[model samples]
Target: MRLTMLTFGLFAGPAFAQPGPPAEGPDEIVVTGQKRDGTLQDADASITVLDAEAIDQARLRDFRQLDDLVPNVQFNEAGQLSNVFITIRGVESNPFIVNRAAVYIDGIPFRELTNAVLSQVESIEVLRGPQGTLYGANSESGLIVIRTRAPSRDAEGEVRVTGSLFSGTGGAGIEAYYSTPLVSDTLAASLAVKYGREATWMRNRAAGVTEPGEIEERFVHGRLRWTPSDRTTLNATAYLLDINAPGLFDNDFFPQDRTLYDQLYGALNGGRPSGRYGYFHDAPKRTDETEYVLGLSVAHEVGSGTVDAAVSYRRDRSDSLGLDFDFTSLPTAAGRDDNDQRVTNAELRYASAQQQPLSFLAGVAYFRDDKDNQKSTFVGPGDLDSYVAAPVQTRSIESLSGFGSLRWRPAFVRDVTLSAGLRYDHTRQRAVQREGQLDLGGGSILYYTDARLASTDDAWLPRFSITWEPTDDATFFGTIARGYIPGGFNLAATQENITDPDVLRYRSETMWSYEIGFRVRSADGRFRASGAVFQIDSNNWQEIRVLTDETGRPVSSDFIGSSASIRSRGFEVEASWRAVPGFDLSASFGYADATYLYLFNGIEDLAGNRVKLVPEYDANLSARYQHRSGVFARAAMNFVGAMALDERSYAVQPATTMIDLQLGYENERFTARLFVDNLTNVRRFSGLGFDNLAFGTDGTVYGALEAPRIVGAEVEMRF
Candidate 1:
């Protein structure tokens, strides 16, 4: 039989149902998306939602599976999964997120802003553009929300095991859901646990490569619900996550030709091996992070409206282990002393009656975050050759913000709602780097206190959105918003300066966006459709530039209107169809035009500058099907357009295509699935080149490789 894409009708989908109205499931109302508890379709901002079912369907284990799912969201992770290159809507691509994005798990925020691996995520929501009011932190571009499933109230449990060929490794997971009645009329409790591990797909014929490096993660979620009387409920939920990922960076090739290596000898340069057959064989580098979160929420009915309050707290700690940095770079065997984060938030909301044609929600929030980060360096004896005590850097950051929004329904229009929001933020940030003069015997003598300087910043953001319903089955909306990112000290800018220091303090950035979208579904609810168009005007954006100032410590330079402008315009479209009984299909595609609008300096870049690794056009299209007969099969594919690597729009990474196929079967108690990612073994660079120019030494941080094509299968049975 010929396979076809899921076809759709003309009607838009349904409006998001508010709580108490009861529509859809828990997965639709993720806190990280809108923080308003609504479906992505009803949300005021642009968002991408990836649910566990969809995650499993795609045979996803890591962020590779997340690529292109969201129009401009790409993994910015480097050397290890501990760093985050997360930018939203090209807001902070070659620059930095500073304020472009903020990450959250449940209602608690992850204070550390790095390209870290996501662990225990039941669903990942990417909110495009600035989200300063609803989410705190540096949410200038938007936000990335990760929601982990909580323990269920009703008792249920399962265990799954899968073995795949290639790495000779097996994967296993056991999950338990238990609920116990407490105090009969007052309380009930629930708990859950999950764990899994797999082997690496890449084979290194080079020296030093070994075993046990496949990605592995474990998750725990638990909660308690208490009801003292009707119309009132109290809930407390807590969760823990532990994740370990081996070295993440891949080297594509060297800049100069390999034949030069033969003539130059190892002396011509570091004379590293041929980049052609690069491999990782030495001790594997690792990033281990653990996060814990707990939240308490209370809901009470007040007349026609409802009053709800929630308080949440979370702590995340990360540690880097082993002899690793990036490939071809110095072996960085180091650790940090203060790699910890803490966040606390409290919110009160008044929601109007949903049954009434006109209803609105007004909320106010207060949040506080404290973080301590310290960097340590240790040089290795083998290939590194030269050795010295690595410098130590410490950072402390804090922020506070407030937000408000109002929604109104017009008397003339029964299905349309209009909303507006405004938010104010104040933050205090400080960084200190003290160079140490420890002797070989280990007696420490502090060298430079002037090497450390501190600074502070403040800002405000505004947003507006409108939702219109031509009919009960169709909805349309438009949004306009302003976003920003905070500035900080650049470590590289310092070392580059010996007598003079690189200037300190990088300022904040702001970007404005306008968007219109539509969601439609057929009368039978069998077919669904949604689409959107957007244009973003970026102001005072940030990017790296070689400066002559000795104190020019790579700082966040504020553009007082010299035209560091950028324009990002794009379209998002999707369709979901049930088509036939017991058979389901879905497909989505997007088009984008991302580019710098103005030339910062009349001096055209000769190296052919491209801002960062944002592609002009990128898309993802997938199709999956399951038969009512309890038999299922699936096939999917991904497409990527060429991306620019520099600011002058000069260097470019050629684009490529990939295809994946999946097959699965499910019975009363068992299920099996076979999946292939990049089935054709297409290898691509996950992102562009980046470097710490302050070294006073040139470290060619270029051509970082990404995930190779992977083909694997999974099988599971529940009892």
Candidate 2:
């Protein structure tokens, strides 16, 4: 038996939805964050658990919207349809880097972070630390695990509609879910669908167009569950995502003084800097993407243990069109990218029953991914036909891993437990790139040579933990773990005119982490709190360095590199109190100090610099009230500290805060809510992007803005 967190039956907004009040004071919760089932308070890890009610109350539609809720977790999208960057505990990676944090949906891994939509999710677990022991490479920083709603024995259904308006633009969303039994207690099925559309606020002055930021999205999910006997069960799920967004508008910014802008552009582009943030040339911002996933899982009881198996396949495709170096209406610069990816994975696991003094588990997994990319750029002045460079690239990856864990409870130590885990992983990656024939403005074509490369890596990750419960209401734990990320060849290494061999491959990165944490609940179960402190020493930290020419000027070469060492230390605290019967308060605060210990790019010393995009401080506070009258309200705010946008600390984005409010009424059959996000209308940049080829300047930065103030209402019906 384990201690569980208490859940009050209250609907604050979206994140707070439950069937009904429990006969007890609060509902108990169970979590499976460590590949084993246990109460959250008993897990020896730093984790944030978002139950279905919490998720809905927060109105978190995507992972990006979940940033400030957890400590030391950051999410930023580059405004490209599917390119998203995530940093956990100051461990971050480049956009094109394949090795980083890992995202899992129902035990199936996904390459794209944005694909983890929240439409049909039952719960989300953010395990914030090195998870390499069980998850293997690329999970060196952390892991995001999503569990979708499972089929129930009885028929159930829900429908929700929401709409919002902000800055002269409006958005709407619709979602529906249904579940029913097919064969009484033996089989069941569930289906869910979601659609959303939003209008962009940025208006292009030069293009004489407004609402260029419009975007539409659709998602579908289906699942089936079959239980032939009490000891055997099988589940299958399928998901689809489709999105479209057209034209670029108000994504860039320039100097209000035309003279200064012109001079700067002239210095960078030989005539004038061609692009402005708010106004662009003839090009419209555009994005179109489609993704599909299918997965199956089976479990059976064998003697004193259980055997589990899972298999999955996924495919993703995207096409985009936008302006090139100059943001103007002229055909001078244009760019396009078409990308496709396919992935297949399989896993098998066996776990001993936890009722004994000793429990053990073992697993094996394999996955393969293949990708094809077609990227093109057209550069010429005011003509439809100009210098065009189109490159086609193909990449393939195969990974195999085996892992095991053991837990022991000694008879002498009445309430003490020791656990250990180890995992071995082997990965092989290969890529081929061919430069398209250059269509020189004239009637001639120049063909370029092709580039091919391959890399293979192996690593062993280990973990050890000890947990002690001195009293029924308090527990203490400590953990030490090792994490790894494999090395691989760069896709652009074989492109034309790249002379630096160092750009071809980067070495594997490893980290050793140490952590201590505690969880406690009040005697009356009215108050709960958890806290953890951790430090990590990272070696061979993968870094993307900007290539420079002899004159120390920036060049078009960006390659994978490594820093000698980097260190990150952080602490987090989360607490919740049920002050009174219908009132609740919760707060979370985190502080981190991450710095480059020893870094040299062959040109300069970057030691002592702060990691890019990792804020030093993050905090959140929330309060909710629910009455027996079926009335509820909540107010919450999140804060993020200042952070540097680049390695050199050349540019910095300031700290910002966001406030949200919600009010709703709920009963047995129906509920309605009104919400306001970004209550203060604070518009800030979520992240910075670098494109030397487009700006022709080394330090130039572009970024996407956070959404402005939004007011919306939602109605949900359940039957």
Q: Rate the local accuracy (lDDT) of all candidates.
A: 0.55, 0.71
Give the local distance difference test score of model 2. 0.71
Q: Name the candidate that leads on lDDT.
A: 2
Alpha carbon lDDT of residue 631, candidate 2?
97
User: In model 1, where is the ten-residue run with the lowest total lDDT?
Assistant: 1-10
Model 1: how far residue 619 lies from native, Å = 2.1
Q: What does candidate 2's lDDT look like per residue over 410-516, in tens digits? A: 99988999999999999998888775654322222334458788888999899999999897678899999999887766544444365565656778889998999
Alpha carbon RMSD to native, model 2? 6.0
lDDT of 1 at 391: 49
TM-scores for every candidate against the unseen true structure: 0.79, 0.89
